[model samples]
Target: MLRKHLLYLTSDHLFAYLWQAGSLTPGPVFGADAAGLRAFALWLADGDTAPACLLADLVEEEFQRQLMPHVGGHAGRQMRRRRLHQLYRDTPYRHASVQGRASGGRRDDRVLFCALTSPAIVNPWVAAIERQGVPLEGIYSASLLSGALIRKLALAQPHLLLVTQQAGGLRESYFEAGQLKFSRLLQTAGHDGMAAGIAGETERTRQFLASIRLLERGDLLHTVILAPAAELDALRPL
Candidate 1:
């Protein structure tokens, strides 16, 4: 085992993390207010004892600078930036802490940011990076990433796997087993955007489950929704 562990971090009212190679609870969710981001950055960067200035630059300049201004708000944008700044000041941009140690030995860590803005809001940031000749691994829809976690944990071993996605033009379910697999993307538009969206989506899920059940003549139930928290919670996979 090469031991690849994924660090999935979402920026929410509190940030949540899941470090998975193997473990239940996946990983515990942790809170990261303005002060916490620096500590987190240090952890992500591993302990290198770089000056606070350098670390802040790494975050603001490298990670958040582009995402900040485009957020567009006379009132909130400055405050968001200021809070992010304060996080930088609180400590070095990152540290390494896995077993409750202040820091040490974080040679391998991938820091993923769960951006709040939509692609339309954040995609332009990439242009600036490209202008500076910075390379990127790739970009993915946040909804897609969310859906992946469920499939990885629950469906990886199943003979037939299905997953649900609920974003504009991103509604879908997938199937796979052995070397066989294909994706089914559904352009399911609900009468009420995403609020009453679930009603229509749930109905579609029911049809999918019913059809699969009939085809297999056995329980082949499968589905996962990667939508807003409220929407995902309200939805019951059919």
Candidate 2:
């Protein structure tokens, strides 16, 4: 059985974990600094050749939804690439994916463009992996993963709001018909005002969605909160 490693990255730290025998062993947590990067490089050099999957839960991420004329084959790929570059020219972590076609008119393709805007937060860790010749499976965003979570949990709502608490903050990702439309992270202070914070943030998100017209007339927003049982207890009344 091949060994696998997982990396969870946030603004302040990068958590490393080793997966063996269906169990995950916690490894070192590296600070996002020069000295930490050096230590991470040394740690990777300890003869572990396992491939890694990096999951980033950073605040500095962007998402844009655009409609473009449907073009298939190689041209479509080039067009999406160019559009991604145009949307986020300065970031190398940009990606675009087609989320089906539009309803009417030209029936254009709906493309979601996203990027990890902070290179300083990610580049060093990625560079360290490259230097060590470790196979990087992929760099994934937590917001993007919420779409899959909704699907896995069988939340089949037309407009869904998925809220998850993470080390960095509270992540609220809005999805339309199972497609991720946008996401935002709020830096929460301790567990003091947890329920209130979630309520306030969730309302704010709804207003923002309406302002942007993501919510249509009489559209119901099904909210799914992913948290521990204790947190859920606190949120149940809200």
Candidate 3:
């Protein structure tokens, strides 16, 4: 059976990644984002060939996460927005922000409330996709995708960091109690030694986690590395 297409959008293009159940099909088209947009428009022109569920990753969106005491109902949402507003007060994209939450624990009092803003990047995409026949089921940040991998692996470490290479760079997402606490994307250079470059970034990420108190001094930070097997092998000895 054919799988639903997962679209991951960058500044100039969208990728249609085939995903069925929990697995993927290779050779995801690089131009699928633009193609999908056109197809969606055509589908709207008629009434056929519209996807019921579409998953998207907005790569250019910026993430700002804050911790807040657990509160319920509309008041909680308001407080979260207020905090988000304050956080982005100086940012140019303040008005074009999206918010989400990653719960720490069932009874945990603290929750990580996240805001992603990139009006220049997100607004156009939203405007393009809205009012179309497609459901446009969910929009997500690329960093958050690592959380799904952690869950799939059933990792139980309290302070774990997941490192994956994407778009010619290394993306790190730190998780605590299955919730994404922090993330960073580092650009790559000089691909002559890919392994060493990745290793350096990995160390930098570890220090960053410590500097931010996400990984405290004397804390054991379990790292989950995702890269080519050869690259991973070289990193293993570091």
Candidate 4:
């Protein structure tokens, strides 16, 4: 069967978009409640409950990423996961997992590691989707998907930041050499006007990149921002 529907589930909203032959057709965005979410998703599927890839954009501020020395094969994966587990043992999140991909052009074949502090909120949706007969092809976080976009963009800047507006807040994903290095969710809402609020958050993200050494003093930092046209225009000058 051809899987063409993409569902993006965030903390408060669920959005359905169409995907066909490398193009995306944006659809409706609705609440995350089972009734509404299922209705819209089925509508997008043309009332068929066939399997589709659920590209979940989780808003939980728990995703972490890093670059590490690459080891080859299955053993390498195990080693990386173990290292990530150890790193998060002291954190408040009790459950987590590590996933990695090879960093580009590194002579030593270093890999980029991504650690996710599992969101407990998504558990209910898992059952909801199953009950509704929506076959779940896969669930993914924004950080992971953003990496693919960064690589696809083939940005000239080695270090860059991508900020997208989501239901709960602004989601920021950091890319180094087109590899996902870090991600965070800023819950900045209603404190100020939309434009200023986003601008302040962008500055904070830049500082974060600098503190982590992903950006150096006076180094060119490129940002790819995804927002509505009005707010996007305001961000253009920043």
Candidate 5:
């Protein structure tokens, strides 16, 4: 059995050892859920080191320390709950940086990584984690993360990735699969119903894919939506 449990961190929440149906390691992370934020690296703290629950309490006093008005608000209080046993989902899509670290029985299969969030949060957190010497292999946003998870489930390599935006227009691109495939961040009506949101996102993704064909189109790889279908109709199969 694995002796050391994994830690999954993100902007909103933190979870230790994320999985999907006992399948793969390096599972997807939900940017909106505070519980999915794995802000700290597992190696940063030894297996026995306990997180300071006081940190949550300390946050309320931070505004005063900054010489700003004290908001007297509790921020990041629930991350340190030692007794939360239901933190992990029952899936094999676990995420980790250290290659051999996540090795359960198969020492050959590589772990996948997906990070979905704005640069403001993802960038700084990534740097912070790296500075602290947290090990990792890949990183992507929630939308891409979700998509990547789907691809893993399908046992296919993703060719394209899509991200949703509330406003500020749309953006898209690709990372590992050369320049042919890409990822996109676009403004869609998240608050709007489902069909509209899915249609908008799907349209944007299609445009980007079609445009990429101008340069050189091989075959469509993969497209994913950050929001679940229940929240908003997901843009899949693009």
Candidate 6:
């Protein structure tokens, strides 16, 4: 049986987990420090070379939405690479994806460029993985995973706002016509008054969308909160 590894990375720590036979076993947590990085490398050296998927939930992640001239084949990929480099020159952890095509005359493709702006936080961890010869499947962000979650849940809202509580904090992702348009993270101090906090953040996010013209005046905004059953029960009233 092939065992899979999952790494949840935040600014403060990296949590490792083992997945086998549909069960997940928690592993050691490595803090974001010199000693922690060294320990992580040593741990990897002793563990099996199972392919790992890194999920980063960081405040430094950035996203930009733009419409680019539609092109295809090799040239299109080259163009996107150049654009992504131009957008985030300092970070190697950058990705670009074409969401859809615009409706207007040129019908340009809608591109979303995302990156972890602060390489200082992620480089050490990646370097450790490289030094240990670990096969990293790919690095993903919480916001990116939320899109997958929406698809898995079969959410078909045209204008949707998805809020999720993660170890790092509250992640709010906004989608237009079922495509992710924007996302932001808010770090809460504690679990106290979490429901109120969610309500306040949702309203603020809605206002931000309207200000950016993403949400039209008086248009309906469908908001979905993803959490465990206990958390959902607490949030249901708001």
Instruction: Name the candidate that leads on lDDT.
Output: 2
Report the C-alpha lDDT of model 4 over 1-238, residue by residue, as the tens digit.
3647777777777777777777777877777677775676466455566566765566454544455655677876677667666766543322233344444665344444443345455665566667667777877666677767766767657778888776656778877666666788766673235567766777888897889777899887687877776675677787
Ranked by lDDT, top first? 2, 6, 4, 3, 5, 1
RMSD, every candidate, angstroms = 18.9, 1.5, 5.5, 5.1, 17.9, 1.5
Cα lDDT tens digits, model 5, 1-238, are 3223243433243334533355435423334233323424433444333221100000001000001111222421222121121222332222222122223443332222322222344444445445655444444233334335545545344455444432222334343342222343444334444445555565555665567452246656454445545655333432
Better of 2 and 3 by lDDT: 2
Compute the lDDT of residue 102 as modeled in candidate 3: 41
Q: Taking the tens digit of each residue's C-alpha lDDT, what string does model 1 give over 110-172?
A: 221222322222323334334434333344433334335555655553433344443223334
Clashing residue pairs, backbone N/CA/C < 3 A, model 6: none
**How does model 2 fare in lDDT?**
0.89
lDDT of each: 0.35, 0.89, 0.60, 0.65, 0.35, 0.88
Candidate achieving higher lDDT, 3 or 4:
4
Tens digits of lDDT, candidate 3, 5-71: 4556654455555567777655334433666566645544564333433333443445545446567
Q: Which candidate do you rate higher for TM-score, 4 or 6?
A: 6
Candidate 2 lDDT tens digits, 1-238: 4688889999988999997787888999998888989989999999588999899999999988899999999999999999988888888988899999999999999999999998878899999999999999999898888877888899888999998888788899999989999998888874555687888889899989998899977988988887877777789988
- For candidate 4, the lDDT comes to 0.65
TM-score for each predicted model, relative to the true structure: 0.30, 0.95, 0.70, 0.72, 0.34, 0.94
User: Regarding lDDT, does 3 or 6 come out ahead?
Assistant: 6
Ranked by TM-score from best down, the candidates are 2, 6, 4, 3, 5, 1
Provide the lowest-lDDT 10-residue window in model 3: 90-99
Residue pairs with clashing backbones, model 2: none
